[model samples]
Target chain A: MSKFYSSVTKKIWMSFMGLFLMTFLVVHLSINLLLVFSPTTNLFNEASHFMGTNPFIQLFQWILFAGFVVHIILGLILQIENWVARPKGYRVKAISEESFFSKYMIHTGVIIFIFLAIHFVNFFLVAKGIIGEIPKTLVDGKSVDDMGALVIALFKMPYYVIGYLIALMILGFHLDHGFQSAFQSLGLNHPKYTPFVKGFGHFFAVIITVAFMSIPLIIYFIK
Target chain B: MDLKLKIWRQPSAHADGKFVDYQVHEISKDASFLEMLDILNEELVNKGEDPVAFDHDCREGICGMCSLFINGRPHGPDTAITTCQLHMRRFKDGETVTIEPWRAKPFPVIKDLMVDRSAFDEIIQAGGFVSIATGGVPDANAIPIRKQNADLAMDAAACIGCGACVAACKNASAMLFVSAKVSQFALLPQGKVEAKERVQMMVARMDELGFGNCTNTYACEAECPKEISVTNIARMNREFLVAKLS
Candidate 1:
């Protein structure tokens, strides 16, 4: 346990788990965007139903949930350890000129955590019929459960769409640092490949964020 | 060739420090920076005043004892050279040069421009060694290290334990120094036997000594007299990971 909790070892643990979370986000965005392509009530219902009832998806979701908890815990641990390592009362005269995303990761991460809580309350609880009964849906010659309806209805609320979009942008900013930094934590940075890794991180963050945010906008404004 | 010097003067560690201005007249351009300072000290002694206190042992630049932040640099304006190797030709006549000691919590001001860097020695004593039994001296080439690994270990070993890296860093981080030491030993087969415990112990000691975290600003490498690469820090991270998992 002492070996597991050592200063350098914690960085690798955080980076591996962060990369795992990044993969999970990619798959999640892909599945969420299916609603945008097929907006018909029955089409979304069938998709959501397939996702809900699949044993593989269920297992993966559990893994993702555990990953989220561990990632956050380890991230907090690493931050605390780094803080403790530094000399007390010493201040740098020079201001760090890195991007806002890179410097304020902990802050952005906290905001994203709040977004996650809202996301869980709005989607996860609703889908499981835990908080409120999901309304019925009928279209495309089929009847469906109300999880898809709840999403569409929530998006229709302008405030909810705006909130979701804001959350996604924060998520984008978090990934901008988290993705590249995790590789750095894992000692994967080399002169020939570091810039490429950083570029890919920025690009991947933008794509995930833009794709996810587009779903809400399409549901709220277009359909 | 006259040079104006603004040297920090403090009677004792508990005394308040301030700069004392002096003018060195007719200095040779070929004179080393510390030699020039020595001439200035002789002048102060002739004037019946206390000479500035600074640290230096080997004028050849290998002892790593000479430390002076000349004109806002660890070793004057030159890159990849220690203070003792710095020449007066790097400065112009009538220039006011400011000299200071290593400023970090771990390194406390002793007097004038001299700072106590025993914190580094403490960190080293924590784990910076391999427990080899002293019998007869082993054959020099018995290890048979790969060319690449030998070169890397030699490069890392080039770090002379200079506190310049700490003084040059914005955060006063000792990562480059600690990592270089760790990499130098860990790269060889003899060192690899205890590589896990070595990295773990060194990093833990580094943190325990109140040094700042490495932000990879490259300042330490830039100002390092040995030009020890930040790549050593990355290597340390990898070694720690391999040790933790396997």
Candidate 2:
């Protein structure tokens, strides 16, 4: 039973974790959009403060972090297994037909990982006051950390803005396949529903990407 | 019609192989792909040279014995047909066709274009069967199966165990093949008794034998001779999940 639960089974769990992270992205992207809607108010700051202080959010944070780590680690392991599956590459590999996004999953995944490291450094470290001082603002009657200020500051840097935009585009590409694929891996497939799922996957990919990209672009251009 | 052939030639599994170019002239277009190969082999034999070795049991395409990676596509450039059923008309006259074996770690080259597909047999042996008593033949109506399920099982059962799915896969993953075997049984009543152990053991053996993980590329379906759907893979996943959880 232990042997049965070891390697390939990780793929099933990774699918669940990958989808969970995708859900987290929807939430994360919505919150980031708060910056573009009203950067001047303490609404974004209040939301951030609540997220940092909320008991449930704090607990979910650990699970979310675990989801990211395991997804990444198992992805690398699967990639290695895939590589070992064919140690000798085909002499003539002319792909007549296959999805374009399906080819460079690891490439896009690596790009997303790099962007995530930089993203966490800019925002998460600042929130924790480990790298930069956290700015405080009063929202409604209570004092809160200026999360929007930190985000707007980062967007002001042209390179960070460009990098963020590119990263979101890559994220979109990753999700273009990842979304429907996770469903397939988890056995949510049917002839009737799969076309819808594929369409929904692409739609979600584009929307999330455009939404996240808008945040950085709006901040850079307006401020 | 005349055609140029660059066929992979390996004397033995341990020997280094290279492409040996040969030209055939005045071949009829209506000739089947295997028939064209037959003509080429005959010419080589007449010239006192070794004939190109390939696999074929039933030239009509049902046996799944023939496999040839022609011009970078499994079973030649045609879609949804085995190499045995492929016609030489698909190739233009004077075209150079490159033939290679099914190149995967689990499927080492036996010689020329033939690969050892026993790994597939091993996967089947792992859990692809149901134990039953014999001696007296049971009535055909003894076990009742749903029409829809019977059709799905028959669809999965259409897999001829050809390595084209693995050959066409970029990662050389046999998920389609393994899943087809698992789904064929998991769908039926007799096979459901051991469905848990079947999926678990087969998947374990698949991993142990060094097949790549399925990344939902769908190339297996695209190039499968039987045109097996990747949905069977999803079914296998569902079975695996249920087995592990329960």
How many pairs collide in each candidate, listed in order? 0, 0
DockQ of each: 0.19, 0.64
Q: What is the lDDT of candidate 2?
A: 0.87
Q: Write model 2 residue lDDT over B1-246, tens digit each, in one string.
A: 999888899999989999888898998989998999999999889999889999999888899999988888899888989999999889898898888888889998998888899999999988888865443766988888999899999999999999888888877888899899999989998789899999989998887887888888898899998989999999999899899889
Best by lDDT: 2
**Residue B205 alpha-carbon offset, candidate 1, angstroms:** 2.5
lDDT of each: 0.79, 0.87
For model 1 chain A, the run of ten residues with the poorest summed lDDT: A89-98
lDDT by residue for model 1 over A13-76, one digit each (tens)? 7778789989988877877777888746566677777777799988888988888888888767
lDDT tens readout by residue for model 1, B127-182: 78878653577798865889989999999999888788888765577888988999
Isolated chain B TM-score per model: 0.95, 0.97
